[model samples]
Target chain A: MTATLNIGFARASLETKLFFRQRDAVIFTFSFPIILLVLFGSIFEGDLEGTGITVAQLYSAGLIGAGVMGVAFQNLAIGIAIDRDDGTLKRLAGTPMPRAAYFVGKLVSSLVLAVIEVALLLAVAVLLFDLELPTDPGRWATLVWVLTLGLAGAALLGIAVSSLPRNAKSAAAVVSMPYVLLQFISGVYIPFTELPSWLNDVAAIFPLKWMCQGLRSVFLGDAGAALELTGSYELPKVALVLGLWLVGGLVLCLATFRWTNRGEG
Target chain B: MTTAIHVRGLTKRYGEVHAVGGLDLDIRTGEVFAILGPNGAGKSTTVEILEGYRKRDAGEVSVLGVDPGQATSAWRARVGIVLQTANDAAELTVRETVRHFARYYPNSKDPDEVIATVGLSEKAGARIRQLSGGQRRRVDVALGIVGRPELVFLDEPTTGFDPEARRQFWDLIRSLAAEGTTIVLTTHYLDEAEALADRVAVIAKGRIVAEGTPHTLGGRATASARVTWADGYAETDTPTALVRTLAEKYDGEIPGLQIVRPSLEDIYLDLIGDAE
Candidate 1:
């Protein structure tokens, strides 16, 4: 077990280095969410109706959710699919490396990227948009669980969805279609207050909605609850939904994960 | 000698297509064995089954004494597989990639030594993507041997290599075989088999049509030789007699006389063609 963990850490370190080495991927992954924040945050000038918070602050908080998903889900799903297509997974499968260690490596690397992504988003939020960091220790505590649960669920789902793409060429399109749709319906692109009830129900079933709501609670505090679809932050439901995804993602990953492309078989 | 690999009645099918059908083989320890075949002749399938990457339908098989279907990590540690078309880890340097794979094995060769063995010491620090096709292939070889495996599987290991690189690769395989590593190579190049393999098996239509030493395969050593002179050429079992007759025809010196036996390639074509 110790040996496996050591290898996993080594894999993680290597994965992280490789992830950052690709300059285009690094720039696009980190900059996309920040760009969205700057674009939408700048265009929508005023505060939410009756709330003291500016529209940009709400976007700053929500884009953090999108940023995490980009780092964990989009990057991983595309990254893993590319590995599968390019024969990385197949080569590793022939080795003595523990299969579980590969997942550990992926999860650890995604977590590292997520941390850096969130920090950059927060920096953008605080510096440009005048968004306030939560003063309460409890809100900070809430941030920990939300970030943990959110990243875990997204990363695992990324691994699961990686199997859906037929090959590396189609990976980005296949992974991003649902992701872009989720951003729209999950209150990242459009606020929960403006979205219809039916859309909320659909979005509630997905982890991104709850993740966005959880982050909003951290950044927006009690006053921002007025903008929530439920008129309050449903923290327990957030935990339940994201937790369910974590388990479901693991099951799907086990079921669908393939070391080689189908054609190769 | 102990058998490094043994198989009997190995069968595999993909839906309606029989990729491997009732194939049998035995590869002995410390011998360089080559499987020669045209495309889609079950070469990759058979190797993958031995590598534990593909399931066989029906077979009694063993590799290094363990059934490959139920091979443990320790079994994997003892075997090295150099994949044919794996173009991954483009961002990683050759040294980093070799070092990373080395950690997977309990007993591993020094990364620098493996890199040098493949003649990539100058490009060790270069990222894999930056290397030429032949250089990239050398990296693949480096990764395969870094584990110091007792047995190595090379699936078309030198397909895209230039002549010089191919010769260098053959030397590497020879050195490894000298060190007592049992090597199984699959190639379309008959000369590669001739240059490296102690024994060669030609697979055609999902079965081995011929198997023997490079010289003796398909009766190549004993096949009738062609005696050629300025006037004509004749296929004869008694090439010496034919040459003597030609010498008499030339009144003591045979004009443009040559005795040529059928090449390994001719035997290979005959075997596969006959099988088809």
Candidate 2:
């Protein structure tokens, strides 16, 4: 067990170095969502009619959710699929390195990237938009759990969706299509109440929606609760639902994901 | 003699096409064994099965005395494989890739020494993607041997090499064999098998059609020879008598005198061709 952990850490360190060196991945996952924050936050600056917060503040929270998904879901799924197509995963499968260690290493790296993505987003949010950083210790604590659970769910969803791309060539398109659709219903653009009831129901089933809501609570305090599709912020439900997605997505990923594109016998 | 690998009645199929039919093989320790076959002749499948990378349909197999299908992590540490495909760690340099793989084994060879062994010391810091095909292949070999494995598999290791690179790779394999590592080689190049294997097995349609030393497959070493002179050439059962007769025809040293036997390639073609 200790050996596996040690190896997993080493693999994570190496992978993180590799991930940063990829300029496209860095620009796409880390910087892309921040760019969206600057674009949308500037364009729509005033307070909405129903909510007490300005558009920039609400967007800062929402884009953080999108950023985490980019790293843990979009980048990870495409990277893993490319590894499968290029035979890196197949080669590693023949090694003494525990297979579980690879997934753990992936989770660790995605979390690390998630932290950096969030940090950059927060710095920009505070500096340019004059966005308020979560002040209370409880809000800070809420931020931590939301980020953790959100990253876990995204990682699981990444692994589950990775099996859908037939090869590396199609990985980006396959992973991003659902991500884009989820953003539409989950309030990266339109707020949840403004969305259709069925669309809101569909978005509620995913961790991304709850993640955006959870972060919105940290940034908006008591006022953001009224904006939720539910009457209040429901932090406990956020935790429980994200936890369920974590477990369920992990089960589905493990059932379907393979190191190779080989057909079943 | 100690045996490094043994197989009995191994069978595999992809739907209806039998990748490997009933096949049996034994590779002794400290010997370089080669599995030579045409493309799609099941060489890669059999090797993958032994490497524990694929499941066999029906087989009684033991690799280093453990069933490959149920191989443990420790078992994995004791075996090294250079796959048919090139190493795909393009983001990493040669040194980093080798050192990364070295962490997997309890008694791995020094990464630097392993890199030098495969003659990549000069390009140690170069990115794998920046190197040429032959140079990248050296990285693959470096990774494979870093574990100091008891047995090694080289699957068509020189498939994309220039002639000079191929000879250099042959030298590397020879040095490893000299160190008493049991090696399993698969290649379409008949000369590669003839150059390195202590014993060679020829498989066709997923069955071993012949197995012997390179010089003697299909009774080649002792087969009928051809005697030729400036005037004419004749295939004869006894080349020695023909040479003597040719000497008499010249009444002295025969001009352009030669005796030739069927090359290993000739015998290999006949074996596979006859099977078809």
Candidate 3:
């Protein structure tokens, strides 16, 4: 089992390396979030001071979710779809490598990339936009757990969504549809609290809203005291919800994922 | 010698279409066995089932003495497969790709030695995408043998190769067989089947119509020989006697006279029924 795990890890690392080497993946995964952060930071500069949360804080929360979505959903769904179309998945299925190993590798790579993206976004927020870092270590720990669970949820969602793409050309459009719409509904672009009550209720059912809300509780500190959570960012409940999403997503992915497009061809 | 592959009543289907309809075969150890069939003839489905890639709807298949559907790690380690299309690990150099695959097996051959064995020593350091199609095929062959498997499956191994490259590949395959590796291959080239296979099977629709040595497949050896001369040709049971009579009529050797039996190509086409 240890050897099998190592095989999965190695394969996942190779996949991650391949992803980073692609010019478009690199540009969108790393640079796109940073650009959005900078753009939003400048636009919200004057309005954020009165609310006691700087523009950078808002940008950091929103863009971090965006970064996770980019890697976990858009990156993974399209990547898997293309692999299926190209016969890569079928070839690997013939090998001794277990099917679980392949998914494990994708999960590991997406989580690692999510951590890196979050760290970079926080650093930029702190340095350029004068956003305050979390003061309480316990809160910081809770924030880490939230991010971990949130990323897991997103990755599973991505794998599940990948099955919708019929081929490589249409994969981007299919995978990106839910992601783009989620950005609007889940406060990745607009804050959830400001959205109408009906929209807020709908967005609450999605893991994305919970992820951004969890992050807001971490960074905004006393400003989030009025929020109804009982503890540090409501970590336990958020973790449970995200964990449920992860399981549900995995089930959907396994049921829908095709090893080859032999039917399509 | 032991039997390398033992398959009986193998069956597979795609919806209502039977891809492999009750096929049975046995390949002995250390021999080169070839499967000949046209496109969509269920050859690939049968091979895939034997390789543990596709599950058979109904059959008993034991490769290296273990059922492929319940294949263990040791069983997989003992089998090597060269697929029709090359894997696209374009970013990795040929050496890197070979070396990466080596780690999967328990007792893999040295990567550098495998590269040299496949005649790809010079192209080892080049990225996979940089290599020509034939060179890329060499890389696939290198990866397939890098594990030192006891049985290797080659699916149309030289499909797009030029004449010289095909000959070189044939030599490589022969050398592997000479070294006691059991080879089961499928190819469109009849000459390749005739030259390399110790025994050949012709598949049509979803069943094996004929199986034997290349010369004797479909009674090809005893099939009426064509007696030809400069003027005309005729099929007869006794071609040597016909040629002798022609030589006597000429009072010397008959000009351009030659007796020839049906080639493997002729038998194969006839068995598959002249759809070409």
Q: Distance from true position, residue A25, model 3, in Å?
A: 2.2
What are the runs in model 3 whose C-alpha is more than 4 Å off? A224-233, A253-257, A262-265, B274-276
State the C-alpha lDDT per candidate.
0.92, 0.90, 0.83
Question: What is the lDDT for A55 in model 1?
Answer: 87
Q: Give me candidate 3's TM-score against the actual structure.
A: 0.93
Per-residue accuracy of model 3 over B193-218 as CA lDDT, tens digit each: 99999999998888889999998999
TM-score, chain A, candidate 2 = 0.97
Report residue B263 deviation for candidate 1 (angstroms).
Answer: 0.8
Per-candidate TM-score against the hidden true structure: 0.99, 0.98, 0.93
Q: In angstroms, how far off is A197's CA in candidate 2?
A: 0.9
The per-model DockQ list reads 0.87, 0.68, 0.42
The best candidate in terms of TM-score: 1
Q: What C-alpha lDDT, on a 0 to 100 scale, does residue A246 get in candidate 3?
A: 80
Q: In model 1, which regions exceed 4 Å deviation?
A: none
Q: What TM-score is obtained by chain A of candidate 1?
A: 0.98
lDDT (tens digit, per residue) of candidate 2 on A1-265: 8888899999899899889878887887777898899999888878866676888988999999988998898888998988888878878888899988898889999999999999999999999888888779999999999999999998999988989998889998999999988888889887777887999899999999999989989998897777776768889999999999999998998899887875622
Write model 1 residue lDDT over A5-100, tens digit each, in one string.
999999999999999999999999999999999998899998877788888888987899999999999999999999999989999999999999
DockQ for the candidate 2 complex? 0.68
What TM-score would chain B of candidate 2 score versus the native chain B? 0.97
